[model samples]
Target: MWHISEYDIDKAVIKLRHENADFRRRLKHEMLLPTDIENIICMASFGIIHLELQPQIIKCKKQ
Candidate 1:
């Protein structure tokens, strides 16, 4: 898990909106874990990271 800033969220949204394929490829190549993606989503949904700066709080447990 990671704490993402509002700026990072905006940048990620823009990058995804314009270059989803590239973003996915990069995320995979960069070895981003599932928790990373969950944190990103939470940041975007809340529109602010400061309110909830916890990491890996929303990650799914491995089987």
Candidate 2:
């Protein structure tokens, strides 16, 4: 979703870091760290989204 905007990276970084703070932490004073947001944006650039479906996790049976 962010790979457009004429491929503008600077604006992307600021928007992501500044706008998406609660996504990283819930504390009122806590915000997404600079390095962490940068890393996230970098991964997003590669279309890589990491998530864990805790309730859907199922162990495979051993043969």
Pairing residues by index, what is the TM-score of model 2?
0.28
Which residue pairs in candidate 2 have backbone atoms (N, alpha carbon, C) closer than 3 angstroms, thus clashing? Answer: none
Residue 37, candidate 1: C-alpha displacement in angstroms: 0.1
Estimate the overall C-alpha local distance difference test score of candidate 2: 0.46
Tens digits of per-residue lDDT for model 1 on 11-33? Answer: 76566646666556546456444
lDDT of each: 0.55, 0.46
lDDT of 2 by residue, 1-63 (tens): 434343554555555657767632422344434454445555546545443333332332445
Angstrom error of the Cα, residue 9, model 2: value is: 14
